[model samples]
Every structure is written in C-alpha cells, then in structure tokens.
Target: MSHGWSIARRLFLAHALFILVLAAFVGTASFVDARDRGYSETADRMLAVATAIADNPLVLEASRGADPSGSLQPYALRVAADADLDFITIMDTDRTRWTHPTTSEIGKEYIGAVGPALAGEPLTEVSTGTLGPSVRAVVPVTDEQGAVRALVAVGVTTSNVTIALNARLPAVLGLALALLAAGSIATWLLGRYLRRVTLGWGPEQLAQLFVYLDSVLHSVREGLVLVDPRGELVLYNDQAARLLGIPPRSPAGAAAGGAPLLADLDLPASLGELLQSGRPARDEIHPTGSRVLVVSQQPALASAAGRGKPAAMGSVATIRDHTDLQSLGNELQGMRTLSDALRAQTHEHSNRLHVLVSLMELGRIPEALEFATRDLELSQQLTDELVTSVDEPVIGALLMGKAAQAHELGIALTVEASGSLSDSGLLVQDLVTVLGNLMDNALDAAVSGEAPRTVDLRVSSTADALVIEVADSGPGVAAEAEEDVFRPGFSTKDPGAYGRGLGLALVRQTVARLGGSLVIGRHQGAVFTVTIPTHRSPEPTPAADQAQAPRA
Candidate 1:
C-alpha cells in the first residue's frame, strides 16, 4: 500500500507550516506594536505644541482682549500650519472656539471634549470632532493669578496616524518573508539529507525490506550469528540460539552490552576466540560438547574510501552440523572397501578355474587335482586364521577384504591378531574409520616402494583396551614431519587432489571421540599404533548410524 506523501515530503511540509505560522505571529505583533507607538508619539507631539502656544504671553494678553478671535485666531492658524497639525483651537472658559482650521468654524463651540482643559489640566486622547476622528491634546491657557482664562487644543487626523504606521509596515513584512525563506531553505536541505540516508526508499519500502530480511533469517537451516567488534553478540537467529544452546528468552541487544548469553552457552574455545579476533576465517571445524560444527567467519568492514586502513566493525559466523554427514561418508567408504574385496576374490577364482579347465582338457587329471587342492587349502587356511583371531564379524570381514586388495596390488599383506575383540562397547563405523584409513595409507606406501613391498597389520586386546598397529616396508616418515602427518590438509601425496590428507585426520578424530589415542612408533617404516579403551561405558549410537547401512 502507498501513502500519498513520502516521509521526506511530510517532514518538509510540517517544518514549513511551523515556520510560516511563527513568522505570521511575529509580523502581526510587530505591526500592532508599531502602530500603537506611532499613535502615541503623534499625540505627544501635538500636546507639546498646544502647551507651547497656550503659554505665550502674546496669546494670553490677546485672549483677554475685547475680541479674542481677532487677536488669537491668526496666531493659532500660523502655529498649526507650522507644526503640521490639522487643527488648533483657542477657546474661552465658556468653551467657544476662537480659532479653527476652517474660517467658517471660527467663534463656534468646540466640537470635541475639553473637560480636562476647563479644569486646568492638560490631556491627550483620540476623539471625533467636526473635522474627523483624530488623536488630539488639550492644554489650558492660565492668567497671571494662575486661573484658566482660555484653552488651546491641537489634533492630528486618524488618517495621518495610519499613514505613519504604513511607513513602517514594509520593514516588518520584509523581515517576516526573510525568516520564512530561510526556514524553507533549511527544510529543503534537511529533506535532501534524509533522502540520501534512506537511499530514496520510502517508509513502505523500508518496512517491507525489514520483513523480508526477518523471514530469511528465521527460515535458513544453517545457524548464523553476528557479533560486534567488542565481542558482544549483535544478531542471532532462532537456529543459532538452538544450535548454541542459548535460551530463547534472551532479548536483542541484551548481548550487545555484554554477552552473558554466550557465557552461559557451551561453546568451544576456538569458536569464542574466532568471534573475538575480529578477523576473517573459513571452514574451521570445532567440537562443541557432543556436536561437530564446521564454522566459517567473515569480518564486517567499513568503506575504504580515502582512508589508509579499513575500519573493523564486527564479524558474522555460519555454523553447519557435520556429524551426521561424516557418519554416512564413513559407512559408504566401508561398503566400497567390501565391494573391492569381493571383486578381487571373484577375479582370483575365475583365473584359477581357467587353469583347471585347461589342465582337464589336456587330460592331465593328476595335475588338475593337485592345482585345485593347493588353491583351496591356501584360501581356507587364511580364512580360518582370520576368523579365529578376530571374533567380531565386522573386523574379520574387513581384514579378509584388505588382504585380498593387497594381493591384487602385488603387495604382500600380513595380519597378526593375538587376542579376541568384543562388540559390546565398540562401534563398527569407528573401527572401520580407524582401521580402513591406516591400512589404506599403508597399502599406498607399500605399493609405491621398490620390489618386495610388504605391509604388516597387528591386532591385540587386553581386558582393559584394544590395540592395533600397522607397519609398511616404505620410506619412513621424517622425524620433523611425523607430528604434522595426522594434521588435516597436510599431505605428501598428490598435491592436486583435494581431501587427500583428511583420512588420517578423520581417523584421529574418531579415536579422540571414543576416548582413544594414536601415536607413531619408532620403526624402520611408517608405523601407526592406535589404542582404544574397552572397559568404559559404550558411546551412544548416532541417529544416522541407526538407519540402514550403505549397500555393498
């Protein structure tokens, strides 16, 4: 839905209205005050002139003459003309006008109030007379004995007062318009600034964008967390809170001040360090309690314009749960190993059958029987040894499969099992990950060596623990490189291949998860030994493992 006015337009209109109203109020007040002042000043000036005319000795003597108008009227007219006054009236104590602006009004009764003047007091007021409404003043003309013998009144018309007020109106209006113009310019500039900040987006658009961002954050399966440069959490989606074991009741910005929520949750130390580092990192696998999480981190940076260095704002991290996927991959690898073993056995039997048929066709019955007996005895003996040495079917099958694979590669492989294995506290997947990787590494090294390449495998279990050791007649590991051999991504093999060095790393991880240990033995060839505790309580079966195993 759209509103007729955008936020910027609304702001501008509101500001302009406020400024206009203020200007109008100030202009009206100034005009009214100036008008009142003009009237008062005009009245005072006329009063001063009236008092001066009434005090003159010549006017006083003339006022007491047998014809007061004949002597005083001329003098009053001359004084009024010089002072720019509309009228000047000289009247007796009887209130008869002796002089007026018009000759016809001479000797007539004054048409305006003279009560104060008759009482010997000077006064100023706005009054209407024969002439018109005027601002007028009245003063008494006293005799030698201080008696009021006559009166003089001076007045200026209301039109003259209005003219004086109009003279000052332009200044007031100009000031008011100037103020309004300044306010409008300021409002326009402010509106432009707001437009830049909002990137021209209206209120409706911004609100819709917020809604979309919120939906995306909530719907994503991978956990995402954002932290500020100070190592305080800024944003955490529902998935992140659940994955990190944080309570859902925590409010936003609650962690911004101080990350009490992060402190309460069981996060790995490496992850906590990454959040605090304010640096970019990628694909770091961390183990948090029972879950394995692959986490990637990116730092937020400010614009690099002109500045020598970019400013670090914060960091964002995404976490993915890899436990289930890793389990499935291990199972698939085990199935492939079993299939390769079956293929090797089939090929071996087919070749022997071809030889036996040739011998029978040549009519060599004794030679055919001897060849068949020798092949059957050798295969049966190896099978019986493996079954007797390893009581667990999974381990027996794995050994048999690896032995056949070794034979196909023309590498002599030997298995020496000194003790029995129980399946009570052992996981077949963990066993395959450990034993399969070690044997595969040994086979690779054995095949790459000179003639007479051989690999030795040993398995023994005490009442407390199970131990396995594998050694190959290949180039031994350097003393300095032995520790780094098990580190993930550290490979001496084909450098072009990705995930080549992860086999030993996965083996080490599995060993650590099961509370076991792996070490390199001091021998002529690369010898790896793994020991796992058997007396402890069994580890819980993973949900993925409980599903159908991978088919061979």
Candidate 2:
C-alpha cells in the first residue's frame, strides 16, 4: 500500500482530513456562538422589558394592587412575550420576589436576587431566571429621584443554542467523506497499476534473458566471433550465425542450434600453424562454406596485455568466393594431358625425319631430300622460340619434360637460384606435389601460347628459407583476376589449357604448412616465388665423407 500510492494523494488526504477537522471545529464554534448571541440578546431585551414595567409607577402600583389597571398589565405582558422571555420577576432587598409575572409562583424566596437594586444602588446582572432555571439578565428599576426600587430578571432557554449546529454539520461531514473517499481511491488505483506493471520482472530473470540472447548470437559456424586475441565476440555478425548454424531459440533439450552449437574446424591446429609463421594468409581456400570459401585473413593485433608475451589477441578471417579454383585446376590438368600427347607426337616425328634422312643418304635420296629442308626449318623455328622467351633452368627442365610429350610446342624456362638445400623438414611426396603442380602449370601456359612460348621457374634459399618462383609466357592474367586467381577453381586461362585452381593454390598451402611465404610476380613473364623459412640445420662435414669414402 505504501509503495503503490502517489505522493500527491497522500498529501491531499492528509490535508483534507485536517481541513475537515478544522471545518468541524469552526462549524461547531460558529453555531454555538450564534446560538449564544441570539439567546443573550433575547435575554437582554426581555430583562429590559421587565425593568420598564417595574420602573413605571403605574404598572408597579397596579401589579401591587393585585391587577387594578388593565392598560398597564396588558402592556407589560405584550412586551415580555414579544421579547422571547422565558421568565420575568421582581425582587425585594431581602431576596424575595415582590411581584412575579406568574404571581402565584413568584412569592417564594429567590436565590439569584439583585439586592443592590432594592437599595439605593441600581444594577444589572446575568444569572438564573425564574422560568425553570433559564439563562437570564437582571436589571434594577430606579425611582424618579434616582433611587433603586426593585430588580427585574428575564431569561430564555439554552436548548435552542445547540439546535443551530444540527442543520449544517451533516453537509460538512458529507463533503469530508467524499474528499477522503476520492483520495483513497486514487491512491489505491495508482499503486495497483504500478504493482501490476512490475510484478513479473526480477533481477535474476533479466540477467538470464540477456545471457540467453547473447549465446544465440555467438554460437554460429561461420566464425560467429568477436574477441580480441583473447577470443571475445564484440559484434559477431549474421553470416557467422549461418556458418555456425545457430538456431533461433534455445530451450532445454532443443535441437543443436537451440542448445548453442559449437563447431570445431581444427581451429587449434590451424592456429598453431598460423602462429608458427608470422604472416597473414591470403587467397586461402577452405571447405568451410556450402561452396568452398576462399578467405583472405587479416589479424588486427593489439599490444601485449598483462604479461611479457602479448598473445595474438585480435584476429578475424574474412571470406570471399572460392568456387572457381576447382575449374581452373581441371582446365590446367587437361592442358597437361594435351601437352603430353604433343610431346609424344614430336618425338615420333623427329625419329621419322631422321630415318628418312638416313635412308636418303643411303641412296633413297629423292624422297628424303625433298622433306629434309622443311624438317630442318621446323626444328630451327622451335629452338629459336624455346631459347628466347624465358631464362631459368628449372623452368627449362619443366619445358624439356613437356616437350618430350608435346609436339610443335616452343618452351622457355628461366632460373636465378643460389645457396644449397641440405635436409628439408618436409616429405619428398609433399615437395613433389608442390613442384610438380608448378611445372605442370608452366607446361600448360607454354603450350597454349603462340610460338613465343616460355615458362620461368625460380627456386632460391636464404640462410633460413627456401624460395621457389615459377612463371609462364601466356597473356598475363587480368588485373581484376589477380586476387581471384588463388581461389579454388578460379581460372583466367583457356579451360582447354589449364586445370581448375588446384596448382598454385596447392603450392601455397604446402608452403604455409612449412611456415613459409609465396610471392607471385610478373617478370619478363608471370612469376611465382615460394619462400620457406628454415631453422639452422647441421651441414655435412667434408672430412667425415672423405673418411667414409676411403673404404671404396
């Protein structure tokens, strides 16, 4: 009740009750006063009338004669009645009524007699009157020579004074009741509304509701994330929601989404791999989406907090479309097959041409000589295109391999390599996969181009790194497709010449595992440089190998 009521209603009711009480007091006071004043005035008028009758010698003489004069007796009776007199009497000095309006009743002794009036002193006093003890006023009547003769007492009833309050107090009471009722009702209503509005909520419930909502937002597959390197989610978005596969509602025993789903995509292993290499991954293709997602990751890092090693507290990976890489890989693979077939045809043709020339020198000269000039010119043109375009031997070795299985194909390969590789911390199979794809890509690009065919393969090493660069002589990739090139299945070359985007991207993947960087560039032609950073490896001592060789 205290909680619900308004301050205004409380104040109003308090003031109202006070006002009612004050009004009651004033009303009672006013009524009592009016009645008293009315009664007193009537009493004074009656006393005066009685005194006048006593003072008139004719009336006094008549009354003393036992009703002798009719005029004086009638005049006194009329004056006393009109003045609302309850009683009238005359008293002598010895405290006895000398004459009374009720003559038979007034001859007894009087207790409230005005004695001075019967002596030489004239007087007035309010006292009990003759008519059954009413409020009264007394006056002394004087003789013509200013001598006190007798006293007259007049009075009216006191009952009429209290009756005045009867007519007005009920209205005042009704108004007070109405005001109090209105105040009580208003206070009660406001309080009830407040109670009703706040009844259902509690502190614990509000906290739990917010927690549940937060869980819904952060439990998504597509990296529903927000966090500094500490892994807090500040504004994990809706795409993350879809990726994480969070359900709309999370009730008990609800489906996975509702229960707050957590998908583990080998994040621990992936993060370990990332930390080992202090480089961001770009054009990274992962099978995280319905279609493969090619992601370029950027880690906006904050300074170390709380410890000597500031951990990678802030990191988010963004995703783009990666579906086209597969197609590119397939196309490159097909071109590799075509290049192989051409290599086989070229070998067969060269062998036949040599056989014809040998037969002509053995005297089958007419037919052989006719085809010899054309064959020689064809070989010369192939050599000219092969040597002029590129400048690396690893690239040339790839071309030589392609040319073995391809015909009418000009190849150009280049290399700028220094320093030697000892024991590398990788599987031969993995290295083969990486280098094989790169060279295969070179073959496809070289065969697909016009006669000015070329491929550049560069592999190098610093004190702690192994870097490989491969380039081709095809028309350079479009500027817009540069970033798109590494996405799985994204291909800019003729589909006939290359596979889907498995080659360069796979190379990049293997490089990443080794904690290395791969750079792609356009030299005289397009080039790719794969850098592998290594730790200090023990070198083979010359003396030990020489000592071992002594047995041989």
Candidate 3:
C-alpha cells in the first residue's frame, strides 16, 4: 500500500527473490543427489573388491589349510591399502573371521549379517563394525565342488562418501550463482525501462490518473482532441467525433496501435490546416459545414524524469459549438438594423410633418399633400413587393430590413423574387443564414464601390431546386481568389480588418449543409449564386432516422 516503492522496483525485487529461492533449491537438491550417488557408488566398489578377493587362488588354497590366516591376512591388508577401503576381512562360513585389517580380530566372529553370504549369494549393506559405520559387501569363496569354502568382506566408511559429495559442491554453487546473476541483470534492465515510461509512478497512482482522465474526457461538454506529432489522432471523445462530423469510436479506432490519421479524416480545410500547423490558438472561430465552432489549442508538453525542460509532445485542442450563439448574435444584429431603419424612417416622417406644418402655415397645403403622397407610395410599393415575393415571413422580414439599411446607406437595393420558398425543403434558419450573409456582403461591397452603387437580389424556386443570387456593383473578386473567397479568414478587404471574413464562410457552410451549391461569377460586379435542392436529394430512410436518434 505504501507509495515509496514504484512498480518497477517492486517487480524487480520480486524477481530477484524468486531467483534466489530457485537457486537455493537447485543447489540443495544437487548436494543431496550427489550424497546419495556417492553412497551407492561406494557400495558397488566394495562389492566388486569382495568378489575379486573371494575368487583368489591363494585365498582358496589357504582356506582348506589349517593356517589360512598366513595367506589371507597379509593379502587382505594389501588389498585394503590398494583399493583405499577402510577395511577388508576374510571369514569362515560359520561367521568366524579368518583374517582382518585389525589383526587382533582374526578368528573372531564378524559383526554383520552373514547368513545370505554363507548361502553363496553375495550381499551389500551398510553396517557398523570395529571401523565404524560403512557400506560393506560380503561374498562366499567356493572350492572345486562349488561348495562354500571361505568368505570375503570389504567396506568403505560413510565419512569418505561424504567427502566425495563435498567435492562437487563448487560446481553446483557456480551454476546457481550464474543463473541468479543473469536473472538479476535482466530484471534490472526491464525495471529501468518501466521507470522511464511510468515516470516512477506506482500502480495505484497510475490507475487513479487513468480513471480521472477518462472521466474528464467523457464528462466535459466541450470536444477534446489529442493529436500526435505524426498527425495521427491519438485520442478523441464522443463529443469531438460528433462535432467534427466523424464516425463514433468503433472497434477499429479503439485498436491499441491503429489510431486514425488526421489526413484521412474529412475535416474542414481551415481546421485541418490549423491542426497541422501545431500553432497555439485561443478562441478562434471557424465554420465547418453548418456549425460554427470556437476552437482553442495548446502545445502538449511532456517532461522526462530528471529532465529540466519539458519537450513538445504534440497538440491538444478543445472545441465548443458556437452555432447557437452565432445565430443569436445574427438575430440581434438584424433587430438592431430594423431598429435603426425604423429610427431613420421616424426621423424622416417627423421632418415631413414639420414641412407640412410649415406649408400649412404658409397656405401651401396642396404641394405638401403631393410630397407626402409620393413618399408613402414609394415605401408602400417596396413593402408590397417583399410581401408578395417571399413566402417565408422570417426571410421576407430579413430582406426588408436589409433593403431599408441599404437605402439609408445610399445603395439601391432591388429584390426580384417569384414562386413560394415553402417547398425549398430547407430550414428557415439555413435560408436566413445564406440570404442574410449574402445581402450584408453585397451591401458592404456596394457602399464601398463607384458612383452607381447598387445591389440586386433574385430569389426563385423550381421543381428541383431553389435559386438565390446577390450581385454587388462593387469591385469584383479576382479570378485567382475565386476558390478561396469562401474559406474562413479569407477576405479581399484590408488585411487588418476584423470580422470581415466569416460572413462568406457561413454562407458557404449553410449552403453545403442543405445539399446546395454556391457559384461565383462576375457580371459588372461580384455575383454570388446559391442553389439548394428543393426535396433533399436522397430522402432520409426510416433506418437512417432511427440510427440518428439519441439513445436513452
């Protein structure tokens, strides 16, 4: 439970202990086995010595004579010395000794089992005699008739067997030490690697950190993404995938070693380029498809243990959906524009009333009436045109407001719309986004252009698609910049201009979301034509609807 020792240290110590225990077991077993083998080999050697002495002719000849000790005793002592045996004895069938290494024991009864030896089968065993505990063998000597004549016994002491076993201890010990040394070295190397990777964190600490990170990744409302230095998407939560229009994490993406690369994903050019640059950005707004996002990114840094400075790892980005906020902001701007238009109309009406009052005072009532009638007719006609042309109320109101604003700015705004936009199969918000952005850009372009500043807007709905075009009598876009004009942060205006690029981008994004196309043309000025499919190119199926539904 203590955090003092890291995971690597604990594992290394465990392995070292295991190796030590194993070596001890092996060495002990080897020593025991050697001891056993030594005793058995000593018994075998004693047996062979006894058999050879028993078959000796000199011993056989002396066995029949009255003075057998004369030939046997000297020969037994010589054999014992030559064979390095503790003792050798020549005895009679009745268990009486004829010769012994201890000359005093001649003619004495042997102190061991001799019944089987007397019956002619040789026997080997461990027994205690005058020379102490020893492994001994006994054999019977036979004459010409194959009858038992005399017996020969030989033995080597247990102490000498132990000494032989001790001789092999060095080799067993050496092998065990070699095994332990090799194992320790390997464990040390593995520990060092683990320490570097884990940064010396214990198992419990790592587990807690993992749990915390997983919880934060899933719980946060904002989309979080991590990309490696190689531009491989290292990690992304469900929100990130959803916001980025990517497939949810599947088994393929979850594979430990198969993270998807950034280049493989269909990301917005602006977003992709930003991520690839690995530059830190704060609260940069970008549009992807129909959604507006506020993105912030920072360089991810990691420090090695004992290293002074952190190294650049990759990048971490957080994305928040700004579509709702952007929509609200646009709505506010439209309201402000209407308010401004209303204020201008009120001020002009007050001025006209003052003129009428002055004319009445001067008795010029008919001229005043004619002037008021002309102004009313002009406003009424424009209102009637907007009401009859645009079917959607929100879009109609938006155009009316934009037209009013354009008029106040000395820009002639003309609207030519026919047929109902009810069947456009596009959301009113999408239509508003597209039309509003185009109108605003057209107004700006016209106001900044030559003498006859004019903006023309045309809207129509057909069986297959709905078409909307806005043309400004301003400097048209250059041919080389046609493709990049709709990209976020691209503008033909001053480089230091702020909030001047996103209008076109939003227009393009809304069009794309509705399965629409936008075309740029030059007809006396910049022309923006948007075409949206009326009935959604391929209608959504019940299965697709179900798939898109949120789970409980």
Candidate achieving the largest TM-score: 3
lDDT string for model 3 (84-203, tens) is 988888888887888887778888999999888888899999999888898999999999998999888999888887788778889889988998898899999989888877889889
Ranking by TM-score: 3, 1, 2
Candidate 1 achieves a global lDDT of 0.81
Report the lDDT tens digits of candidate 1 across residue range 157-234: 999899989999999999899999999999999887776556556788777876786777788999888888766677
TM-score of 3: 0.82
Against the true structure, what is every candidate's RMSD? 8.4, 18.3, 6.9
Best-to-worst ranking by lDDT: 3, 1, 2
List residue ranges in candidate 2 displaced over 4 A.
1-350, 353-400, 403-408, 414-422, 446-451, 493-499, 540-552
Q: What's model 1's TM-score?
A: 0.65
Candidate 2, 1-552: lDDT as tens digits: 254444444444565666567656665666566565666665566556766666677644544455342444345456567765555555554555654567565457775756555555434444544455456656666656765545666565555434544555576567556665665666566644543333333445546766775676545434433334434333444665444344333333332222231222223233334422434766555543233455455666543223365446455655444445554554455466557756676777879878896887799877787677787798667555544433434333344444444334557555444554434444544455566677776667667666677776555655767677777886655667766666545665543343366566666666776777766667555666777776656766998778778563
In candidate 2, clashing pairs total: 52
Specify the poorest-scoring 10-residue window by lDDT in model 3.
248-257
